[model samples]
Target: MNNEITDSGVATGLAKILADVAGRLAAAPLSARDPLHVPAVATADARVRGMVLRGVDTTRWTLRFHTDSRAPKARIIETQSAVGVLFYDREARVQIRCQGTGAVVRDGAEVDAAWEAATAFARRCYLGLAPGAVTGRPSSGLPDWVEGVRPTEEQLLPARRNFAILSVTVDEIDWFTLAHTGHRRAVFRRDDGWRGEWIAP
Candidate 1:
């Protein structure tokens, strides 16, 4: 019995070390030119098709992504705030899945601040037609307003109606690590105030 307990302790310690390494790898920045530097939002469609929507991480716990106000996912979010965000590092073979509730920021300084940080290219996604509008075949291409015009900061200021900010509050995180010895899984559940513990990896 004593030997079994010792073996379990050692395994748990190794799992903790592996989990730490994996977490750091997933949080590390992507390549200088990699567009995925920002966090990606995972949304589930009717057929369970998982779509990753990329967005910038405002801070460690907060992420900001802009979607057309008319997008179907926006409405889905409004009705159902629960979501899952997956962050993984292939080299490290570590993946972190966060399940949480999301809320849309509508007014006040937070919305204004998010708007200020948005790039012209990002803001361009909301211009012209509404989200999910039908597109008919054109002889040439999309109109000049859609294809040619890029909105300046001034042009985007009043267009806030089409912009939205989603805030996800993480409640649980599942950490998985792949190592030569074996696979390790740890589930971290939030406790009162601030505390966490590793259970059965």
Candidate 2:
């Protein structure tokens, strides 16, 4: 996820749509660090939240994200695995919707690696109170002592337990683009070997 892949520029074929989707998704985690890197992840219960894109494996069509194991969405995903991800590149005028099954892995080699890769400052979040926990007032949930400071290794020990990795296996992709002349749209399904079909925009 290090190499930046820029837009390939105006494309109009189904094959191009598939290739574009793959290329964008593959590079999202590595390069685009704003809106594209923070796609909206929706669960079965109609809950949606922006999550940082951690990695993408186009060969397997799987997306990786980091989440707190104590978060309610983590529990929801553990039970109802069906999920959808929406990615939009406003500058490129393209939107990609992905349907898939998600899993929250609280402990494993993958989880461990993700946690270890996170900066001490980034890892400080897991050390905070559980997400959605009712607080007396608006709060970051982080301890005052750790605020604006990177925690040491010893301070990050407990946070590791709350760290988890979310992996989504994409099954379908709907690609769309807006333009002055006309809009283009297409769909690709894993069940059909990812063969894309142009659809009415």
Candidate 3:
């Protein structure tokens, strides 16, 4: 996600590998806009929805993604903060699963700062009239301007009201690697101050 979550030693190394794998897949050829390249986010009600990997904050042990406040997953977090995110890249044979507390930020210093960092393309994601909106017709329901042309920063401004940052403050991380020689598995936890272990695959 944003700049690859630079870090150090084991933690940094592992995060970098995961980021690289996800990046490759996310960058693969597809439509102008595709959610297939994104990872999955699990809500409290057992709903697993796709979401782009917006950013990763390794220092804070949190993963970030942008979404509409009206989205079902967004509502689920308001009541149940527990959330899970899964990242898997078949080509790289790596899977990164994280369980964490969910936080919905609509307006705040963090939100503003994050929004500011978003590129025009990134901000374009929020161009919909309403994410998860019910419509009588079959369509993406995104505003017309988004499909025809790149909305200017001014046009993208209204999205701020609907834009939300779903930040996952990870408490645990399960990493698995599938390999012919030998599979590797590990678990990292924030409990008792950041504990890690090599577990059986």
Candidate 4:
């Protein structure tokens, strides 16, 4: 009997598991970068008190998200740059957790590039009055400044003042999968490389 688990077998198994988890995450329509994209995001607002944002796997694993400058979450990032993002897919029975430190980037070529990529509707997210302001029941739609009409280039300039981009540099990722017969877990940490271990289901 071949007691040794071939590296190919291990790789294949991990690939299949990752693909299944990715499918589940895609089906859930959760933003890989924004935990708020998940339905349960609001429920944990009090405890977590921040948005679950993901980063792109680029040179620095740049994690970008838009928020109003006045939102409390911005302050949270300022005080505490370290944060975690959690992703769970019920159908696939998988969870992905990412940890990293965040920073706000404003007024630069990068900011301009990100802003250019945003759609007009997304830009509208920043047009409202100071974020987190309490408001009574609206008798009508949002104000003209924010919704009554499209913003011009000049208007967008000031709007950029309120827009903020958050970048997260990933330090580690923990991936887990649950199955009827068994469970799988892997932790990938920067600088330390990768480690895999199996646990009882």
Candidate 5:
């Protein structure tokens, strides 16, 4: 982790750091290779899973993730709400920890748009068994016929029912970076209007 830290002049301002985070997240959804594209999302019950970063709503201070409505975490999030998302970019040696409340939107404008935006192959996951089902054997959970194949619109009809969006309204963010000279950390809260404050790392 320390090896990635370079002597490049680090921005010591809270606003700059916040802007950097926003920019990285804004680009995450467009590129699968982005380090922040798949972040570890944890529910209130301590279950954590890597979820694809679907969209970011900066105005609403929300992060959107696509998930199956039948997934265990989806049900947990609907009831518990409290959740955490961790993002780390090794090359930048930065870590962003976000705490928020989540909501599972099964049938809404956002869900419909996300579903429509996904490719036929990408949407195939929802056509499988619910995540975490006991298959009693190693499995991708996807049906055998759809393996390595994209389903047609008619074949994908049922998948829309299982598809849902996990939207998290971020309340707080803790950003940390490791450096050779010294480490930097900052905390930002929505209640404070995102006027971030630096903290000792």
Candidate 6:
């Protein structure tokens, strides 16, 4: 936490920070090698989980991820849309705190469009018996047919029962950078066409 500070310099600094993180996200397919891959997502209940970086829509200032329809995350989003998304670029010592509202799109146009755009590799996760299922075994609980490979599009059509899109509409962003000399922190809000301020770190 820090004191109130606002200036053009703060705005520019914030943009550069955001752009840096956005650039890392743009290099997606989200591999372990990527600077930013798994982001921490928090629900209204304070449940925090890590999810892959699905896609970043700068045009709409939204972030997308796919999850099981029956998962708690989906129901949480349905009731309380407020969510917190965190992205960290360890090498750069930068962390982004995204404050947004999330919506679970199941069979709607948005989900249909996103499902179509999802690569076979990405869509493979949903082709399972159930998400977060408990079995006596220590595995994903997916059957052999849909395991270890991308199911054919025909095989995947039925997987829609579990597939859902998590769309987060970002409204506020807090960015921080750590340096040897000191630290910098800034916040940007969408209200009134984007306003930002710098605060002591």
Which ten residues in a row are the worst by lDDT in model 6? 1-10
lDDT of 4 by residue, 64-155 (tens): 65667777766777776776667676655767776778677777887778788887766766767776576676623335655667777666
TM-score versus the correct structure, for each prediction: 0.69, 0.89, 0.73, 0.70, 0.89, 0.83
lDDT of each: 0.56, 0.84, 0.73, 0.57, 0.86, 0.78
> Which residue pairs overlap in candidate 1's backbone?
none
Clashing pairs in 2: 1-30
Looking at candidate 3, the ten consecutive residues that score lowest on lDDT are 28-37
Which runs in model 4 stand beyond 4 Å of their true positions?
1-55, 139-142, 192-201
Q: What lDDT score is found at residue 200 in candidate 3? A: 91
lDDT of 1 by residue, 1-201 (tens): 011112354556644543563335334443433322444465554312233233434224444445666767778778878767676667767677776777777777977776677677666666656655776754223245646667777766556787777767665667777888987776654433212344555
TM-score for candidate 4, residues paired by index: 0.70
The lDDT-based order of candidates, best leading, equals: 5, 2, 6, 3, 4, 1
User: Which is the leading candidate under lDDT?
Assistant: 5
Ranking of models by TM-score: 5, 2, 6, 3, 4, 1
Worst 10 residues of 1 by lDDT: 1-10
Q: Which regions in candidate 5 have their CA more than 4 angstroms from the true location?
A: 1-12
**Error of model 6, residue 165, in angstroms:** 1.0
- Candidates 2 and 4 compared: the better one by lDDT is 2
Better of 1 and 3 by lDDT: 3
TM-score of 5: 0.89
